[model samples]
Target: MLLYSSVGKLSAATCSGVAKNITLAIVLPRYNTAYPWAWPRVGPAIDLAIKRINHDPNLLPGYSLCYVFESSEDDSGYCSDSIAPLVAIDLKFTHNPSAFIGPGCHYTCAPVGRFTSHWKVPMITAGASAYGFQEQKTTYSFLTRTGPTAKKLGEFAVHVHRFFSWTKQALMIYDDKKSDNRHCYFTTEGLFYELQKDNITLIHLPFQENAEDLDYQQLVQMIRMTGRKTTMQAGIAFLLPKRGEGGKEGKNELKKGKEEEIWRHFPRTVQTKNLTLAVVLPRYNTAYPWAWPRVGPAIDLAFEKINQDPNLLRGYILHYVFESSEDDTGNCSDSIAPLVAVDLKFAHNPSAFIGPGCDYTSAPVARFTSHWKVPLITAAASANGFYQQKTTYSFMTRTGPTQNKLGEFLIHLHQFFNWNRHALLVYVDEKIDDRPCYFVAEGVYEQLKTVNISVLDTVFQEKEGNVDFHHLLQQIKSKGRSE
Candidate 1:
C-alpha cells in the first residue's frame, strides 16, 4: 500500500524494536484529459524507483521514507491552477522536506521553480525541460532532467535539413499558443539564422494556434500562391492543444474540427519519395509487444482519423527518430526473460525479440531485475530507478542522478544551515492517483529518518485550484518558533 500523509512530521513508531521514519513530498502537474501524453510514463517510473530505494539498504542505511503526493489537475482553461495551490500548501503545511521532485510539465515547473527558489530547496525535475531551468541562471539549487531540451531538438532538425540539402526556401509551420511551440520556434529560428549565414534562402510560415480547426484553405491558397515553379521545403510543427474536462469528448471534437479545417484542405500531391515528413517526437518500433500492441493502437487510431480527411488520404510519409538505446539489437535476450516469469507471468519465449528503442518497460523491468535479481537494462527510461542498489542486476544503468543524490544534496544543505532538528514535511495525496513520483519521495523520506532527522509537521494539499499559502506559512513560522 502507498502511504502518504498530508500533515504532521514523520516519526518512528518503534514497533517490534524496528524504528523507521522520513518524509518527502512529490508535486506533480495536474493535466486534464487534454494532456494525457504529458506524463504518460513518468508517474509509474518514479513510483517503482522509490519502492526500490526504500527496500535497498545500500541506498539508505536505516531509513524508511514516507511520501506526500499532490497534483495540480489544471485544465486547459487554467494551465497553472493545480500547481498554484500546491505552492501555498507546500509553504504552509509541509515540513521543510529534505527535497522536492516534480511538477513534470514545463508549464507547472515555472511556478514550482519560483516557489522553491524562495526556500532554497533543491528540486529535481524528471520531466520538465523548460528554457531557463539550466544550472547557471536558475535560482533553484538544482534542476535535473531525463529528456532532451527543445534547443537540442531544434539543432537536430537543422542538422537534418543541412544533411538533406533542403536549405533553400524552407516553409516553417509553428503553433503560437504553447511554450513548447515557442521553444521549437526560437530554436528552429536560431538554426535557420545560422543556415542563412551560409547564404541559404529560408522562407518561414508562422501558424498561430494549434492544429485544431487549422485554416487549410488559407494554407492551400498560400501554397498555390507560392507558384508551382517555386517549390520550397517545409518544416511543420504540430502543437496539440490541451484537453478539456470531458476527456473523450475533447479528443473527438479536436479530431472532427481538425479534419474539417486543415487535413481536409491540404493539397493531395502524389507520394513524392523525396518529400519527407519528419516528426520531432520519439520513435518507437511497433514490433515490440509492450509498445507495438499497446501504444501502437493509439498512434494508428490518430492516423486513421487523419486519413479520414480526403486530402490526407493520399500517401504522406511520417518519419520519426527517437534517441536509440546504446545497444539497439532488436532482441530482449538480456532483459525480457526474467520479466516474463516474475512480473508478466508469461513463460520465457526464446523466439521473442526486443525492440530497437526503449519503451516504458524501465520501471517494471527495473523492479523485477533489482528486487528479484533479474538481468535487464532500460536504455530509454530516465527516472532514477537503478540508483542505490547493491546488486548489479537490480541497479539502473540509465543516465541521470539518483534519488540518493538528491537526498545527499538535501542532507548537505541541512548541515550547511546548521539545522539539526525541527524539520517539516509536505507531500501530495497519493490516493488521488498512483503516480510513481510519490514513491520516490517516500524513499527519500525513509532515508532521512534513518539518519535520525526529526520532522515537525507534514501536510497534504489538493491537486488543483487555489491553495492557501498564508495559512501554511503561519503554521511553519509557528512551528519554527516553538522548535
Candidate 2:
C-alpha cells in the first residue's frame, strides 16, 4: 500500500517572494543502538536520498526539500508505539512539517499512522509491515509504506512449504516480555494463520528471554525426540531454530556436515506417474475475448507436444481437464470461476491451473489456487494487482503484459513530451460491464503520482446507452488543462 501525497505551496514567503522549503519531520528510533533501525545505520541513506530529491529539478518544481529528525526513543530495544506518537505530536506542533517520514519500526509506525490520518498529514515509512496494517484503511489512510510488509513473508512461507511438498513444521518465536514490541511474534502471526488455514500440522513454540528456571538442554532434547517421531510418522520433520545459536550457523553446519543425516531423513522416491492440469476458460462463450476458440487449441497443441516428449516431465504423463468460467449471460463470471476451480481441484486433484482469463474472474480463482499451492498461469488478467505475487496474487504467473507495464510506458511517453500537467478522464459504464477504462486509468494515475505529475482534475463519466461527448468535453475544458 504505497501512497504519496504532493506537498502543496506554503502560505509563508521569503522577503524576495520566494517560497520556503517544504519540511518533513523524520521520526525514527535514532537513540536505540540495540536495533538495526538506529540512526547510525539508516540516517546516512535518508540524508543521501533527501539530497538527491532536492537536487532533482524535475520533482516538486518550485519547492525545495528539507527535513528535521526527532528520535522516537525506542531505547529499550523494542519500539514503544506510544512514545513514538507523542514525539511526532511534539514535532507536528513545533515544526509544522508538511509531511513525516520515519518511525521505521512496525510497532512505532502504527500509532503515528493513526495520528497522521486524523491530522490529514501524509507519513511515509519503510516499516509498519505487520499484516494488520494492510487492512486498516481508515487508521493508516495517510500512511505510505516504502517497503514490503509481513503479509508477503506469510504468503512466501506458504509458497515455500507447498513447493517442498512439506506437510508438517515447527515454528519458534521469541517472546520479549519486557518490551512493548514483540517483533518476532507480531511478524509471524500471519505465517501461523496461513499454515493453519492450509491444514498443515504446525507446532508453535515461544520462549521468553532470561528465564533462568527453564531447562534449555531438556527443551532441545524434547524437540529432537519429536523430530524423530515426526519423521517416522509424517515422512518429514521441519524445525526453525532460534537466532544466535542454532539458527543460521546450525543450518549452515547441517548443509556442510550433516548431508548423510538429511539424506537418510528425506529418502528419494519414484516420481509421480500422473499430474492433472485444470484449464479454466470461457470454453463455449464468445461474449468476450480469449474464448476457447482463440486460446484452447494452442494450449492443447502445446500439451500434446510436451506429452509426446518422454524427457520433458521425466516419466510423468501430463493430463488436463477443461472447465468453463462463463455464466448464464455468456460472460466470464468471478463467482463462477472459483466454483469451477474448486470442482476441478476435487475431481482431478490438479497440480496446476490455467486461464479463467478475465481480470475479475482470475483474481478470486487465483486466491484459491494460491492457497491450494497450485500454480495459475494466464496470458490474460493483466491488471497491475497481479504483479503482487507475494501477497494477494501468489502462485499467479502472467505470460503477457500487465496494466502496470502499460502505465510505465505511458509515464515514459509523458516524460519524453515534458507533459507535467494533465486532466484524467475515465469512462466507467453505468450498466453491467468489464470496466476496462477504470482499471487502466487507475494504473496510469498511480504511476503518474510517483513522478509528481500535476493532475488538474479527474473526471469520471458513466457511459450508458447514449454517450454525452459534449458534457464530458465541457467538463475537461472547464479545468483549463493544457496537456
> Could you tell me every candidate's TM-score relative to the true structure?
0.36, 0.42
Residues 270-335, candidate 1, lDDT per residue (tens digit)?
Answer: 752221211111123334333334444564566456555646534653322111211123322212
- The TM-score that candidate 1 achieves is 0.36
User: lDDT tens string, model 2, 142-168?
Assistant: 888888775677788778878888777
Point out where model 1 deviates above 4 Å: 1-22, 29-47, 75-82, 85-93, 132-136, 139-141, 165-175, 178-202, 206-483
- Weakest lDDT window of 10 consecutive positions for candidate 2: 245-254
lDDT of 2 at 44: 79
* Residue 212, model 1, lDDT: 50
CA RMSD of each candidate after superposition:
28.9, 27.4
Candidate 2 regions exceeding 4 Å error are 1-272, 458-483
After TM-score superposition, what is the CA distance of residue 63 in candidate 1 from its true location, in Å? 2.6
